[model samples]
Target: MSFNNANGGRQLTDLLIIGAGPYGISLAAHAKAHCLTYTLLGYPMHFWKHQMPQNMFIRTHPDSVYLSDPHESFTLLRFAAESGIDLPVPLPRPLFVDYATWFAARTGVRFTPEHVLQLSRTADGYEAVTEGGGVYTARHAVIATGLQHYSYIPDTYDGLPPGLVSHTFALTDFRPFAGKQVAVIGSGQSAWEAAALLHMAGSDAELIYRRDAANYREGQSGSELIQLGETFFDLPLEQKREKQVQPPGSAAAFLRPYVEGKIRETGNAVVQKAEAVDGGKLRLELSNGETRLFDHLVSASGYRIDIGRVPFLEQRLLELLEREDDGNGRYPKLDAHFMSSLPGLYIAGPLASYSHGPAFRFIAGVRKACRSIIPRIVRSMAHARSGSS
Candidate 1:
């Protein structure tokens, strides 16, 4: 469908997808199959292409990397066969990005490469202002921006200068720190992997966490979790929370062997305090009654969902949407259809995990989210059209 008006005026579409990640791409593919006029905005796989370290590997299995579509025709397996690649268990980041790009092309999903700078409500629907001076109107809007935007740095590093500290999301290359001593904070997959990657690049890297010990597990096939599907959404909130919380200091079993003898690991230790020492170094006081200095710090501490951090959302819309009373108001309270309290606005991907279930946090959840969200959008549009007629 033609998105722009023939006279080159403001474009109008039935649906506006605000990201080009797995969630956004999946949603757009479903919408196209359903014959809905939609506009997708954002660079495809922006985070994976620019933010992630080039040598890093994803924790998800190859079976879980497929972007969802109505027919399920495009999958990582098919891509691997067509592209003549022997897919690995722990997929490399570059391969996954390539697969996503191929999926988009094969599915005929096209997107405008500009990001929405501001999204505000209009009388008929929603209006989005793009960074490239483009305006588009849609009867419905879905936000699928992934986790990179929500990278979380703990308050403990507040005193350190920005030059000396960075979240893993911000550091794409480790060669600069080749001869320097670096400390990676957190015990999760990202933390451990960052430390290992830094050490591999000649940095004297150390992994530090507040847990008693690192929790390493065998490679996950993700079939069981994928089977859970909607059943996870049926559980009680407290139960869902229990299943969602990953063990402190958790890393994939394969990572242990790679990082073992190469990186120093300290457990049951928290950065109680930090200060900038002379010669551009950081002095950190640990909870275990130890003091140390490092040339740099990487807060692999991971992301926390806070809708307020989404810069494109306008103030009025932000205040109007209902948020879950989960103490921190980190997630939007969504219904069974993934629609937010504000009508015609939907949220997916990790941002929807709190309300839908923890499964939404992974790429495996993309199909489930598309199945729920696309049909709801179609039904809502039909209802609106009949009423207008």
Candidate 2:
């Protein structure tokens, strides 16, 4: 399938995946194995290379980091053995990105390397507008954009100007904040990590959280067998709810030694709220009512899952899909096969986690998602042909 010139001037496919992240790539690989025509768009590992800090590491264990394939030949362990690289537990970011690129090449999964500017529903299926002035139509579409669009800044800092406030997701480097007084909000991994990075980069950084004190994840006693089903990825919806006890922003994984030491040395800080004051600085009201000014504030407050944040999703298409909100935010209702209210459209990755369970938020979730969705896609294709005839 030549995606570039498939139908002359424009491309078309049986399945259109809008992201090339872990989930997106995995889905495309499955579609190919099923002998289904599919087209993948977007830069592979774009966030891992650009949005994340250079020195950052994935919280997931090396054994757990993977994209699902039919033969299972591209496992991290297999990749390490083939490449002769020592794969550690907390895998380095650069190494993982390399593995992803290598996997895509080995699988022979062709990608368009274009951004999907907008998406809308069509009579037969859907239409996607690309940044390169290309139009693609597909009988089915899956959204795998990941958490890039879901980064949330608190409502308290709503009135603050852009430069004075930002989120950790937007910070690729800390050198720009050198010699400036920066206040980091939240006590989770991103918050503490950002504070440490800022301080190490020559900024006077401090972490402030609503909790009494920071809580670090306790170390495990011993290594356990790494199994997909046991990892909570294959659990039923009710069981998944029981297992996921931590709050949304809480990081169950511990920080690296160097970053932890830096945060501890800075001492504990708590905040009640923040307000904009003179000189374009933020005046933070502490729990004890003491106020302080800072050059900038970074909200590591974490992501709020809202379906509407996806800018490219046309409003009409969005409204047509059935959604359920649990007071926090709205998420599309998905079936057992991860198909949305729209018969042919599917939702994967973090966005579908709410309906399917927390397992959809991790790489472990990709296996089940692909296994379930691909077979259903084949069935749908067969049904469509039979109906048209």
Candidate 3:
């Protein structure tokens, strides 16, 4: 079912995908392969290119980072072999971005480079309005925006003046903090890695965390869990939750030697309070009663997924959808096929993790998500067409 929109006459398609990251691009590729109409919108790999720190290495294995297509013709191994580049163990961010760009080109996945401002329910389906005033209508809409909009910062440091405090998501360069005292907060891989990067950039960087000690996953590879595919999803909820919450401070084992002497680690501590002081420095009061001064503070506190935080989703649409609370947070309730309570709407990527299991949080999960969702969408489109005829 296709129609020209009244607003600027944009063509309507069967599926409207709202993001252009791994999940969104993978879904579009599958839709195209299945002969389904889809309109994919967003800048390709925007978060990786702009948000992530330069020269950073991801914990996910190089073998697990490929964007999915129906034929699996564009895997990372294929890209590396064809391009004559050797694959690194812990993939570098820039190299993975290059592979994504190459995969999109190889699969012919073209996307609109526009920010979607609003998404609301239409009479026949869902409608999305882009920043450029373009309208997109489709029988089904998939939300695969990923973690870009969900950066989480603790409220304790809220009183610190602007420019004195920033989240890791907002920072890509550490050169600005060179020769300055910097405090990096959180216990995740991101936090530890950011501190290491800052130290390498010549900052007197200290890693602060509330955990007793940094927990490094020495021999474990996430690819093992990712390879489980649907088997992991079938685990009991308790088991799933246990796997979902990686120990705070858990980072790739290889990083331990690289970052050990470069950055100082202050465990079992958190910044209880912070205030701006003279010369634009921040005075932080630690929970352990130690007061310290730093030129800047970086919150590597990671992200909290909440559909309400997504600006593009209209309030009415948010209200109509059902949600699932996983003890730690609430997420959209999704069915086996990744469909939300709203019949024609679906959720994917990290947002679908609560219902589909934790694998959806990484690029490795894209194949499974697309595999489950695309067939359901194909059937829905066929049923809609038959009814209309």
What tens-digit string does per-residue lDDT give for candidate 3 at 1-389?
A: 11223243356678999888889888988988898888888888888888887587878767666788988889989989999999887788899888888888877776877889999999879998988798888888999988988888888877677799989885888999999999998888888788888888899998888999888885446676566557666778787777777554577787887679778889899788889999888998999999899999999888888888999999999888888876544698888888999988999988987777667777768888899899999998788779999
lDDT of 2: 0.77
Q: What does the lDDT read for residue 300 in candidate 3? A: 88
Best by TM-score: 1
- lDDT values, one for every candidate: 0.85, 0.77, 0.83
Tens digits of lDDT, candidate 2, 207-278: 777666566764332123123323454577577667544463444355646455465322245556777788
lDDT tens digits by residue: candidate 1, 1-389: 11222222366688989988889989999998999988888888887799888787887788766889998999999999999989987888899999888888888887877788999999878888887788888889999888867888888788678899989885888899999999998888889888888988899998889888888987777776666656677888778778777555578988887798888889999999988999999998999999999999999888887899999999999999999878888789998888999999999988888887667777767988899999998998889889999
Show pairs that collide, candidate 2: none
Candidate 3 Cα RMSD (Å)? 3.0
Tell me, what's the RMSD of every candidate? 2.2, 3.3, 3.0
Q: How many residue pairs clash in each candidate?
A: 0, 0, 1
CA lDDT of 365 in candidate 3? Answer: 80
Q: Could you tell me every candidate's TM-score relative to the true structure?
A: 0.95, 0.89, 0.93
| Residue ranges of candidate 1 with Cα displaced over 4 Å | 1-8
Flag regions of model 2 displaced more than 4 Å.
Answer: 1-8, 218-256, 264-270, 387-389
| Pairs that collide, model 3 | 187-249
